[model samples]
Target: MDKDLERFVEYCKIDTQSNDTSDATPSEAKELNLTKLLYKQLKEMGLEAEIDQYGRLYSKLPGEKGLDVIGLNSHVDTALEVSGKNVKPQLISSYEGGVIKLNDEYSMSPSDFPRLKNYIGSDLIVTSGDTLLGGDDKAGVSIIMEVISYYVSHPEEKHHPIAILFTPDEEIGRGPEHFDAKKFGADYAYTVDGADVDMIEDENFNAAHADIVIEGVSIHPGEAKGKMINALRLCNEFDASLDPDAKPEYTSGREGFNHLMAMNGTAEKASMHYIIRNHDMDLLQKQKDEFVSIKHRLEAKYPKAKINLDIVDDYKNMHEVFLKDPRAVEHADEVFASLGITARHEPIRGGTDGATFSFNGCPTPNLGTGSYNHHGRFEYLSVKDYRKMIEIVKAIVKA
Candidate 1:
């Protein structure tokens, strides 16, 4: 456990923040820093490891032939919202409660995040406020690595064949762009990238993205009247036409939202990016339809303005795939029972790389990494829970 935590800390220090703007498969060249390290570590374990051209690391451990070939996956990249470089993680033990300060400027409290109270008696790894802790999926990677290390050291222990995948660009939704179901060769898999250790994710939001561009006539302010069509003003009006309550800040659990991700414009031209999400297909369609409705409404309102709205499907709910083949969830239930752990099936508020893998053929459900408040400075990992999840994975593959 100590050695695995050491690996996690070492990984946290490396900057692996993915770039959404970059057209590269891994998104950022720096992402290969961690990928290379993981590749070397996996090789040290005496397993067959290789990195694909897309920057994904695949490794395998031979087990009993009769058992199913299981797969484990996690991403190495950190969120782009905060800096992941030069992360100084703080190790806190014997917590007596109250506020835990990340730094002078930032502190985490139960008042703001009630989940802090759950880790009252456990050890924690937190950020130093200048950057995010990167536990979102790194902890996931650590858990998988620990499981592999265990079987490697104890070759006598019988278990299922394990296929490992460490991906890059997950923070930007490109983690599964290079996924190969045949190459991994697993009957089922799990993406260890969730918050709590006591929950399993079986469903995720059906997602789509809308790119809106508005063109208008730019006239001098002195002659501006009905003749002057400000594209920026139209952008504001277009966003304002959407339902005020149907936004990310206002909704949660089962409720869909239309999130305005980015907006930029001038008097003659403007563009807005929105991500539409919902657990239900019908509701997601409504959200997409609403975008078109607003566009047409605005077009009628402004005859001189030209609005080009493009909506593309990002990913679908993995629940549909799971419905056809539920062995992944069923096996997880058995593993939890064997370990005397009670984990509930919950829908992930966000998507994981598992969603894409599931649609492709592998019904990959998601598990937790014992981390909380991801993609921000206040992010933390419960060391006690982290250790526990390692045990859970070991039991899952036991032969």
Candidate 2:
């Protein structure tokens, strides 16, 4: 098997799901399993690699001097919504089109995912219906690894100084926590974390989260008539009050939405966790305002109860930074164009570690991993496009 393909399949077998509830760095200890593998592999390849206490793996592959130091980053941890454990990758030799059964329980069709038609003759790697494939960033990781491996083995082929970063908990939005850009030593970077191989992304959602706590007056059923105030009902009412159309299911292409991540409670107290996002900063604030507005309304309706709403800024859109300096994106486009690929610049509906990296000193843009339907059982990787990404990143670092 090819090195990149071999690396991807091997890494997918390990479980590295991030935990949102956990306050610890990396969120879960199991995440280090893959980090340790990367650390060992980097060492074996004679590269200077270090694994930090925060579960971040940083490495450098020395290249031609005086060239801009370029960075490549991808997250190690998978999404929290799906089960990334025991992920069995299903490989298709040549996709002729139609339904590709993952297992007895589930199957993927081009009708459901029109993009599948884009890779008719390409080899593919899919999940076995039981769990997620973890291709969201693993594919990115493999691409970076292969690129580094290529330049390392053939020192005669000159390239720019390369800084590699594999982060944890990107799915939970903590990928950039404790990250030091100056220490990364990269003038610019690219996050290989998107879907399409031909697209380059610099704009991302202005992300913020809202945590709502509802305190209610509980009374016995025997005399509960007018004194009873159920927190569960208030939580449901709070969700129902939000605009029905203003949600992820209904929004697309730079549109903003308030996603209810999780909510649970009883008659005494309940909590609702929501993530609000928009490309425009003003629109993002309006969504936050809506959260505060509903809290006041619910409190007024249930005078005996107290409602606490906390909204915190997570990450801003990286577009602002790119607008000031377009060198990183322009460089990527030029490289892609040289490789006979038209670089499509699009806004990212979701944020990548690049968003935070751009805000920090290093201007960063997001590239793709040729993986689709991320964070779900239906997720799959296109071997042809995946290989193309390796070439694209390789071109970006060429002297």
Candidate 3:
């Protein structure tokens, strides 16, 4: 087995699904499992690696003087939207291009996800039907690990100072909450957290998380004529008021969305969690305002009920910061071109830790690791693109 693929498979088996409700940096203790593994591996390879109190792992590879310090980053935690536990990776030596039956309950089909056709002859790493493969960022982590392993074996090929950061809770938008830019000491960085092998992402959604709580008066059905204010019904009403056409399933390609991530409550109290996203800040704010407006409308309609809406700013589009200093993207494009790959610049509909890193003083752009259908059971990685990502990392550092 390829060492990188082996690392990815090993990491995927450990459950590292982040908890959005947790205030801790890692959000879950299980993330430390992977953190410890990465830290131990880096140290064994003679690199200066350590895990912070917050479960953020930093590994440094020393290089010649006068070269700009570069950082390679990837998240350790998988998305909380799906089960990342007990992941059994199924390896396809060579894809023949058709529906891949993960199990009787689920399958990955080219007709459903057209991009599967892109990797016809390449090897694939997929998950069993019951869980996600964690390739969303595990693939990225393996690529970084491969680069470090290569440098460890070939010390004479060293070029620039390199820093490796494996973060926790990226799936929950807390990946960079405790990231110490000064400690990492990298002039620029690239997060290997994107989807396509040929694409480089510079822009991401301006994000905000909204929590709506509806408190209503609950009474016996016999005595609840005009006095009953059912919070559950009100919650349904609130969700119905939002634009249905602007949801994740309906929107794409620069279109913003108000995604209702979760909802749980009863007649007395109910809560709806939403993630609002847009490329433009002004438009994002407008979307937020719409959420607030809906809350106010609900509150007005149900005078006896209390409706509270809280919107928290998550991360902005990293492209705003990158546009000011585009040397990172330029260097990445040069490296991609050198490897016979065209740099396809695209906007990310979702957020990444790079957005937080870029805003936090390290200009970082997102690079792809041949991952597709992230955060779901259908997720898979292309072995060919995965290996190429390792080479891309080496090229970026050696350049």
Candidate 4:
């Protein structure tokens, strides 16, 4: 465990933040650095490991009796907010019940996030307030590495065949794009990528991407009084047509949103991208139908103006899949209880790699590692909670 934490800090020091605009598979070459390191370490532990063409790492620990294979997965890429480079982790010996200073201006405060009271006697690992701790999934990766290595080194532990997969570009929602489910050869999997320690999410949002492209005819500026149909203006009209009350910033919990991701165009043409999300299948269909109606309305207003809408379903809620197999929930609950954690089954407001993996036939769910306020400067993790999660995984495997 000590070696794992040391290696995790080293891994976080390398900037592996994925770029949303990049066309490459890994999105950034720096991501491969961790994959290479993990591959070497897995091989050193005398296990089979390799980095695939798409820069994902897959390793296996063969088990006796050929029982249903269990898989543990985590992503290596961090969010693109700040440079993940030169990460310096600070370990707090024990919570003193006051604000812990990271720098002159910044400190992790219980006043802002009252959940800090939950870990009053627990240890913590935080950043220098200048960069993210990268504990989102890096901590998960470290736990998986430590647990798997321990089991491999001590064969006396009775556990099912385990598969470990490290994915890239998960921060950008493309982790499953390059994944081959059939090749993974696992009965089921769990993404050790949740925010809080006892969180186990089997339900997530049904996500889709919408692209609206508007084409308008631009005449001479001098005679533009009657002939100019600005595409940029139409984009705003389209945005205002959606439900204003249902947005990420305004809504929380099960509430969904029509997020306006990007917009770009000249007078002749304009394009806007939106991501629509909802948990209810019926509501998701209604949202798309409304978008189609909006497209027709714009076309009617301007006969010469052309508008096209493209919608693609990303992933669906995994509730049905989990319902089909009761063992997954029962096993996780049993393990969390054994570790003295109150397991909470909640719906993920956002999508996860497990959601895609579930749709792709893995029936995967998300498990937590005790991270909070992710993708921001205030992000911090519970050191004790993090270590407890490793024990939880081991218990789950044995169960």
Candidate 5:
């Protein structure tokens, strides 16, 4: 087995699912298990590595004088959307290009995901139907570790200084909450947290989170006819007011979305959490304004009810910041072309730590690790594509 694949499977077995409700940097103590492992490995390789109180692992590899310092980053925590515990990885040495039955309850079919056809005869790493594979970023983590190992072994190979960062809670949008760009000492960086081998994302969504709370008047069943205001009903009304076609399921490419992530509560008090995204700042603001407008109109209709809305800015598009200095992405493009890999530039439908790092002055772009069907039971990784990513990283560093 490839060392990177071995490392990936080993890390996936550890449950590091982050918590959004926690106020801590990592949001979960279990994430430190993986962080400690990474820090130990980096130290064993003679690299200067340390894990902070927040579980963010940082390492440095020194280069010869007059070389530019580059940063390589990936998250250690997996998404909370699905289970990441006790992952039993199934490795197919040579895929025959057909439907894969992960377990009794679920199967991955090329018909559902046409991208599977591209990996025919290549090795695939998948998870059991009950949990996610955590390949969304673990593959990235493995790739970086393997690249560092390569350079450490080949002392004759000259390269630039490398700054390695393994962050937690990226799946929860808090990966860079404690990241210090000046301390990282990198002129530019690339986040190896994207999907597919061909994708090299320079743009991402201008993201925000909206929380709506509605207070209603609860009355007795017999007297509820004229006195009661159902907060749950108002929640549905607000959901219906949004453009249904602009949701994640219905939209693609550069289109934006207003995703209602969660809703809970009784008639007396209810809360709805929504995520608004757009590549265009003006359009993102328009969607936010529409949310406020809907809340105001509903408040007027239910005069006896009280409603409160709060919109928080999460991260902006990295392209806006990185475009000013195109060296990072241009270097990646040259690397991909040199390796005979077609470079595909697309706007990331979701936010990445690179967006936060870029806004913090690192001017980071995102690279792919061949993870597919992320944050779900159908997640899988292509071994061939994973190897390509290692080469891509090596080339980027050398560039």
Candidate 6:
């Protein structure tokens, strides 16, 4: 196995799934283990490293004066949909454009995903069709590690000062809650969390969450007709109110999505969790307004139903800052084109640690990790693409 992919698989085995329910800054206890492990590795590489009380880990490599410090940030948290613990990564020697069987029950086939053709001659690492491979950001972390190791081994290479930061609870959208941007001390940064080899994202969705609560009167089943109202029925109606075409599965590219995550109800009460997302800020506000109008209409129909709707704004597009300063995006594109990789500019349908960092202070952009079908059994990364990413980093630092 190549050194970077080897290190990535090792890190994946050490689960770091974050908990959103915890009040702690990291939001999970397991996150500390990865932080501590990274601290040791950084110290071994002869860099000053520290893990703050909140489980944020930072490391520094000093360089010549007058050279600006560049930061590389990656979150150590994994998505909560699958088991991150005891992840067994399967390595395919070389892609031959066929299905890869994971167990008796599941397989990843080229017929289902045509992108597999892009990896016809590359090495691939995947999961066992039972658990996730955790490549979402661990691949990012591994890339950072390899770059640091390269610089440490090649002292003659001309480079500026570098900062390494590992954040926690990124999967749960709280990675930047306690991030000290000033303390990070970098003029700009990049989050290696994208899923393609040539993707450089400066735009992300304007996000907001909504929680709908409905109350209904319960009566004996024999006399339930007209005397009792079912909250579950109301909840179903609420779910159907959103445009069917605006769902994750239906939308693609720059199109928006309105996700009705979950609903639980009985005759007495019902509640739903919904998240609204769109790239344009104006459209995002309009989506929220539509939701509010729907709730009001439902309330008017059932006077005593007592429906409550709560909407909370989450994050905004980083393109505002990117437009203000186009140097970073332009420079990255120039370097990527020079390296023979086509730079693809696209809006992120989801959020990233870079979005929060960009809004807070730094104009951070999300770079590619070369992984596909993240947070599932079919997750995989191209070894060739991963190595090309390291070259992209070198080009950025050298420029």
Residue 251 displacement in candidate 1 (angstroms): 0.9
Candidate 6 residue runs with Cα over 4 Å from true position = 103-105, 217-230, 236-241
Tens-place lDDT digits, model 5, residues 321-379 = 86688888888888889989889999988887898888888989999897888999999
Residues 231-304, candidate 4, lDDT per residue (tens digit)?
Answer: 99899898888888877889777778889989999988999999999988788888888899988898899888
CA lDDT scores, all candidates in order:
0.91, 0.91, 0.89, 0.84, 0.89, 0.84
lDDT of 1 by residue, 1-399 (tens): 379889889899999999999998889999999999989999998999899999999999999998889999999999999999899999988676889988889998989988878888888999999999999789999899999999999999999999999999999988999799999989999999987777889999999999999999998999887798999999999999998998999998889999999999898999999999999999999999999999999999898899999999988999999889999999999889778888798888888799999999899999989988899999999898898899988988889
Name the weakest run of 10 consecutive residues (lDDT summed) in model 6.
61-70
lDDT of 3 by residue, 108-195 (tens): 8999989888889889999889999999789898889989889889988967889889999888878888889998888899999887
Identify the superior model by lDDT, candidate 4 or candidate 6. 6
Per-candidate TM-score against the hidden true structure: 0.92, 0.88, 0.85, 0.91, 0.89, 0.90
Judged by whole-model lDDT over C-alpha atoms, candidate 1 comes out at: 0.91
Highest TM-score scorer = 1
**lDDT (Cα, 0-100) at 119 in candidate 5:** 89
RMSD, candidate 5, Å: 2.7
Question: Which parts of model 3 have CA positions greater than 4 angstroms off?
Answer: 20-25, 98-107, 211-245, 260-273, 291-309
On lDDT, the stronger of 4 and 5 is 5
- How far off is model 4, as Cα RMSD? 2.5
For candidate 2, give the lDDT of residue 142.
91
Better of 2 and 6 by TM-score: 6
Better of 1 and 4 by lDDT: 1
For model 1 the TM-score comes to 0.92
- Model 6, 225: alpha-carbon shift in Å? 7.4
Candidate 6 matches the true fold with a TM-score of 0.90
